[model samples]
Target: MEIRVLGIGCARCNELEKRVKDALAELGIAANVEHVTDLKEIAALGVLMTPGLVIDGKVASQGKVPSKDELKKLLGGGK
Candidate 1:
């Protein structure tokens, strides 16, 4: 799967990346995780806020870092 974490190298952005990795590890899923730091790219993805989470090219969450449990859901484990 393809996952993108959009941010401008902020703490929250880094934390979100870590959470994404942790969630992926817990779920035993291998994904190509990328960190998007370009403003243009992030905007093109339609994320208006930092710490955006994009799963398989679709916007999943934005503006704040989500908990690992929440990430598990976002990663397709739950509703």
Candidate 2:
């Protein structure tokens, strides 16, 4: 799986990335996680807000940092 965190290096963005890792670890899932900081690229992804979360090329969330549990649910098909 591929997970991308889109942000411009803000604290929230960093936190989101960390939570993504934590979620992956908790779920015992391995994924290629990337942090995207380019404005143009983020815009291209249809994210007008920072701290966007993308899972497998699909936009999952944006504009805020979700909690670890929320992230896990999102990663786990909302279960």
- Looking at model 2, residue 36 earns an lDDT score of 94
Tens digits of lDDT, candidate 2, 1-79: 8899999999999999999999999999888899999899899999999899999888999999999999998998823
lDDT of 2: 0.92
lDDT of model 2, residue 35 = 97
Among these predicted structures, which one has the highest lDDT? 2
Most TM-score-accurate candidate: 2
RMSD over all Cα atoms, model 1: 1.9
lDDT of 1 by residue, 1-79 (tens): 8999999999999999999999999899989899999999999988999999999878999999999999999996422
lDDT of 1: 0.91
Worst 10 residues of 2 by lDDT: 70-79
User: What would the TM-scores of all predictions be?
Assistant: 0.94, 0.94
Segments of candidate 1 deviating more than 4 angstroms:
77-79
For residue 21, what is the lDDT in candidate 1? 97
